[model samples]
Each structure stands twice: as C-alpha cells, then as structure tokens.
Target: MKYRFVIILLSILILSSCEFSQKRYKPDWDKWKNYKWILNKNVRNNINSGFTLYKKNANFNLIRYNENNQLVIWEFKHHNYVSIDSINFFENIDLSNFILYPGQTFNKEDILETSVRINSDLDIDLHLNLNSDSKIYEYINKDKVKGIIGKVSQMSLSDETGYHQVLFDFPIRSYNVATLFFKRDDSFFILILFPDDGLVKDKLKDLNLPELNE
Candidate 1:
C-alpha cells in the first residue's frame, strides 16, 4: 500500500511539471518558423540587403537579387569543413593539421592560432573548465548535437567601423547544427553551432538523421 501511494504521487508530480512547462512557454512554433521578418532600416540599405536564406533537405539557399531585380538563389550543400574558413580563419590554421581530442589541455599556440581571423587579428584567450569549460560538452536538444563554445563577433558590412558585440560560448567540437542570421548596424551576424566532443563527430556521415521538427 505504501509503495503504491508513492508511485501515484510521483506520477502526479511528473504530469504537473509537464503541464507547467507547456504553459510557461506557450510557443507558437509555426509562426516562429515561417514569419517573414521585414528586417531593420539599416539592413535594408546595405548592398547585401534583400538577402534571404531558406533551409531545405540537406542544404540551404542563399537568395539575393541582381541589379536587374531578378532573383538569384544559390544552393549550397551543408557539409563539414574542408578547410579553416569552416571553423574560423584564426582557429582554422592550427586546426587544419592538429587532431583535437576531448579533455585535452590547450596551450599558448592554441590560443594564438584560434584568434587569427577573429575580430581583425585580435587575440582571444581560453579558460579551461572554470569560466568557460572546453572539456565539458553541452548537448543542445533542439539541434540534436553537442553544444558550442567560442567567441562570435557580429559586424556591419556597410560601415566597416560599425559592429554590435561579441558573444562567447565553449568546447569547439558534435554534428546536428543550425545557423541563424541577424543584422545589426547594417552588418550581418551569424549564430552557428560549434561541435562538442561526442558521437556526432564520429558519425557525421549519417546525414539522413531526423530534425527536431516534431
């Protein structure tokens, strides 16, 4: 009788928690996905303005207009990095040759090499396992991959001097990923998933995996 009562209480608690979470986030997923944003005034004025990207099965489209007002859409396959630009120009140099493992210690050269193409040659530092733990990987449930870590800069293209700010997150390693674009001060900023150490890197070729659409 005691064990049965405990199970009933636990079941009620789990159901209540689920109900609370759903009410808290009352998310309109469809509206968030398909809403055509008008973008800000600064974004409209740039030469790269009127650009839009829509993701498809296994690829994405980079859509823009030519001088004639005709649409030019370039479809690029979503694949892993072939070289340094795939990561960041700065992080690319050393990464091309070096093989990184989980829980490994990073050195001075690692810092220097990773900061090369970021923020106009500005140097970046890494703090292992304390402030920003590189060894600990986060699994972002939405994208179904290991979490990301590193500093991302969003800059304006019209005025080279204008930029928004830098965001830092960790372990530069997984697979399932998503990249979102935002325009600030007439510059474009992209939020991309950085791989964490896991089965993702090992099984990247399994391209037909399901997305979190449900």
Candidate 2:
C-alpha cells in the first residue's frame, strides 16, 4: 500500500510538469522550411474557390500559410512582419497585380497564416482581453511604425467568433496589411498579408480598399 502511494505521487508530478511545459510562451522563431502553400489542404472544397485567404480582391496576391508554429519571416524587402502571434491579427487587404514574379521569392512575401495554441503560459490571453488596445499600440510603436492605431472588431466566421482588423500596421508600417484571428477549440489562427512589389508606399494612401468583413 505504501509503494502504491509513492507511484501515484510520481504520476501526479509528471502530469503537472507536462501541463506546465505545454503552457509556456516560448515561441519558435526560426524554421522557414515548415511554411507550406495553401493549394493542398487549406483551400475550400469547391474547385472554383482559389487558394486566397478569407477575403477577396486585395493587393495581397501571393499568399502562403505556415504549417508550423513559428511565425513566417519575410526574407527580403520592406514588408511588415509580426513577431508576437497574440497581438497581430488579420482583416482588410487590397488586391494587386502581384503574382509569382521573375525575381521575387514565392513563399516568403506571400500570405502568412499560422495557428497558435492558446494557453495561460504565453500571457496571450491577458494582453488580448485586458487592455488590448494599449498593448497592441505599444508593440507597434516599438516597431517604429507611426500612426498605426488598430481598432479590433468582432466578426463571425463559420459559427466562430473571430477578431478582425483592417490595415493593421505592425512590424512594418510601409505595407498596408489585413489580419484576422479565429479561435478554433483551444487554438487561434492568424492570417497576415503582404502586397507585391508593384504596390509601393506612395500608392497605399491613395487606394480606397474595402475591409475583409464586407
């Protein structure tokens, strides 16, 4: 009976450790090879439905969703990149003539979408729920991107309550971005878009684009 008690204690300790480890906020930054094209499984059931994001007619031509946990890093150019998955979400992006160009890389600058497991260890929930406006602005300001005040709106996606924002200027302010966050069970997915080289900084202000919610 004494031996059985010891074994039970050890099992409890192991389970507690596993739970703590899974809840930690250690983000995986490196590993670009895990990024995958949406043509395979990310697409909708219809053959006519192309491999674009939840929106339509945006300058964000080339799009790719990351299959792994790490955030997709833009290899070159001045496209905006989000480091923290919790703060950056997706919404309104403009369509462009951008496509697989001769010189530009394919997967790097395209649409980056990834789902992160929601847990208390990352403090993502705290920042998102408690004073999210201040936290988001603080992070974006730290990136040296000025006048980027994102107003998050709640939207429904297939029976799920998702967060939406248009022209989310983060990590990079030069590019107009659309990001969306949807909670599926215990995890939330973020979809971010970057315009092609043809859409320059000078033209962004002039274009009157529609929000993804429309």
Candidate 3:
C-alpha cells in the first residue's frame, strides 16, 4: 500500500479544511465587538467633500469601521481568539499623542521603513496585518519600541489641494510615530500610532486628528 494513498490523502485534506472553515465563516457572535458603520453615498460624499480636521485636542473615534474585505473577514473573528480587544478612545481622550487611533502594534519588530510612498491602491502593511488584535499600544510612540516605518497618504477629495497629512517626526530621534490614510468607494481608511515616547511633542504640535463628518 503506497503509504495507503498517502494516508487517505491527508485525511481528506484535513476534513476539507474543516468543512471550508465551518461553511464560509461562522462565528458571527454579532461580529464580536466594536462596530457600527454606515457611510454609503460614496462613503458619505467622500467624507463630506473632505478636509476639515482641526479638532486639535483629542476625541478620536473611528471605532473599528471595517471594509477591506470586511477587515479580512474580521481577522477571521478577532477580538477574542483567546482575549484581546481594549482600545477605548472615543470619549474625550484628554491627551497623550493627541490622536492617531485605530489599532495594531506588537511593540517592536525593528521596522524603520520611511521613504514615504503610499498614495493609494491599498497595501497598508498588508491590510494592517489583517487588522491585528495584538493590542500592544496606540498612543503614538515611546517605550520598548522599534516600530516606525509606516507611511501612506492619499486622502484625496477629488483633485485635492490643501489638507493633506502624513505625519512623522524624525528629528535626532525620540521614537515617535503617526500615520494616516483614507480612501472611499474602494474601501480604505487607516490611522495608526503606537511608537511614542517623545512626550507628546509639544502637544503633538497643537494637534489636528479630526476627520470624517458629513
């Protein structure tokens, strides 16, 4: 018996991949947690004719709004594969790095990629690592950090001009980070920060994290 048909074809390919992942995703425990979206209308007229972020002092809220293949199928059901989902920042975030909230960080992996080249057509660190639930931090750089290579910008509002942000600070080094990217009608809107330790850089130079409101 030639290895008995390779052990019955690897046990029918692991039971047909667990019966096609329990029939094309089944664990919709109300999509776990943190969700509430409704933009449609070309993503609410492209964030309502774009460019209007002057909030300056925190209250950042994007609350896990997915749509990059439904956050890659909700990271295949994240928030609790073994527990981890506590970002809590949408109710007067009094200060810190100002505002760069979204989520995803591992504390460090020695990333230093900054040549600035992300004007659209999504890649966003491969969909922000399929929306990580690792939850290392998200207040903009500092402590046991080694992650700051992210760069992307193309928050276009149709032939844009004026408001364009792609924040970063590389002055003699203090390990701080901030990144933002937005796009609609094709899905993509990202905000990330978690490499801080630069002591809120003079209140993030008087902040401006507000965006999206129509």
Best by lDDT: 2
Stretches of model 1 off by over 4 angstroms after superposition: 1-28, 31-88, 91-168, 171-197, 206-214
Overall lDDT per candidate, in order of appearance: 0.25, 0.28, 0.25
Total colliding residue pairs, candidate 1: 8
- For model 1, the local distance difference test gives 0.25
Off by over 4 Å in 2: 22-27, 32-214
Which residue pairs of candidate 1 clash?
A: 90-117, 149-169, 149-170, 156-187, 173-195, 173-196, 174-195, 174-196
Tens-place lDDT per residue, model 2, 1-214, is 9999999999999987776555332323232223233223433121231232111111122223232111212121122232233343223422122121211122233233222222212223212321222222222222222112233221111101222111122222233333333332233334333343322232223222222113
Model 3 lDDT per residue over 35-73, tens place: 223333323322211111111111122212212111111
Q: What's the number of clashes in each of the models?
A: 8, 11, 8
**How much lDDT does candidate 3 score?**
0.25
TM-score of 2: 0.25
Q: Output the worst ten-in-a-row residue range by lDDT, candidate 3.
A: 50-59
Error of 1 at 69 (Å): 41
Estimate the Cα RMSD of every predicted model relative to the unseen true structure: 19.3, 16.3, 17.7
